[model samples]
Target: MRYPEQYLQFIEKFNEGEYYECHDLLEEIWMEDKSDKFLQGLLQLAVGLYHRECGNIKGARWMFGNARKYLARYAPSRWGLDIDQIILYIQSCEQALPDADSIPYAKAKAMAFPSLRLLIDQS
Candidate 1:
């Protein structure tokens, strides 16, 4: 499935710290492109962030694990996304899991999820 020319809306929601909205925005693309591992990784990451922010430790852990595995095969940059940066962001969340398990978004420094941006074509 071909994606739209831009994913700026996703980035907007993400940067706004609207993790749940990010999940919804990306899921639309993911449903159409089930074969895209990158999309899966992204979706998992978004859900993981959402769960983390919402204080759902169980869901956060599951989604992060999936994202780590799925995103491992790709480079740091692809599909206008900084895959490595995202993976590192997820890893940071993993490290803070114990601290975040009982706390909410306001209290967890690791729950601060980064916004994703589509890369601009140089051409």
Candidate 2:
């Protein structure tokens, strides 16, 4: 299959705000397609979002850093996604990292999480 079954699940889970599940689903595909840099970046992004939701600021920051490395190659568009917004979102996440680490848990919990989106190809 060009796109694994888990890939579709990842898209669904990610869009549904199930970041944890999205991480798991993306990993299933990433494990099999290690050569796909775009997929690797997407997986890291998913994991980062999950960690952020769970209040693991360190994990989130680390994953976002890793995501930046891979995602840099595909900025505006890649793999049927509009990743420009995502890159910007990640930058904001990086900026918030310090505050998230120092702030109280309840206060940090109020921070919004970025949801992933796929650019639908009408053609």
Candidate 3:
């Protein structure tokens, strides 16, 4: 499937604290490409962020970790994200690996969506 611009827009919304909007935006891409690990990872992170806004920490952690695992093998940085910064951020997040029930996007997108967020989170 062609990379959709809406996906980019979702990330923009996410960075702006529009968690719900991001989820809604990514859901479109996700529904169309349910089997795509990259999109799944990206969408899941958005949903996780939505959950984070709602205080669902456990769900956020699960989705963020899942997103990272998928993207780690895929090198999502080519699509976005700063490889060097990610390596460093991920290392730090890993070292601290909060044991909370959730991984919050307002504070954890770098280690959550990681590269996908990097593309959208880039100011």
Candidate 4:
């Protein structure tokens, strides 16, 4: 399936660790169709990463949890992306952080962030 330009931009921003920009790019498309689970999943993933970057552990956890729920149906691939791999990365992020009201900024900053790659079509 052909991907939207904004979605392509989202992927670029996402891989570059510009999570906020990723959100901005994807939210435009997502707003047009709230029922689009795939878009919701990608948007949530971006927001989750943004929250993590900002040291909002609770928010990050919340977004990550919801992202997984939305994206789960799309696994293990969709629109040239590895949905399963993305989900696994989210799982790892959730696992790495402690279940607490808040975590230190340094802790959050020290955590390794995840990046995604689109699967190139050879056909």
Q: How many angstroms is residue 111 displaced in model 2 relative to the true structure, after the best TM-score fit?
A: 2.8
Q: Candidate 1 on 1-123: residue-level lDDT in tens?
A: 333633567766767767677777877777887987876887787788778777788788899999888987776666556777777877877776764345665655454444454443333
Q: Roughly what TM-score does model 3 have, to 2 decimal places?
A: 0.63
Q: Model 2 over residues 10-115: C-alpha lDDT tens digits?
A: 8777777787787777776678769878888888888887677667788889899888888888877765666777788788877767554544567557876544
Model 3 lDDT tens row, 5-71: 9877875786676767876787777788687776666666566556655556677667667766665
**Which 10-residue window in model 3 sums to the lowest lDDT?**
113-122
Give the per-residue lDDT digits (tens) of candidate 4, residues 1-123: 677899888878777788888888988888999999999988998898888877888998999999999999998888888888889988988886667757678887887765566543434
lDDT of each: 0.71, 0.74, 0.59, 0.83
User: Total clashing residue pairs per candidate?
Assistant: 1, 0, 5, 0
| C-alpha TM-scores of all predictions | 0.75, 0.79, 0.63, 0.88
Shift of residue 105 alpha carbon in model 4, Å = 3.1
**Residue 33 C-alpha lDDT in model 1:** 74
3 or 4: which has the higher lDDT? 4
List clashing residue pairs in candidate 1: 80-119
Error of 3 at 41 (Å): 0.9
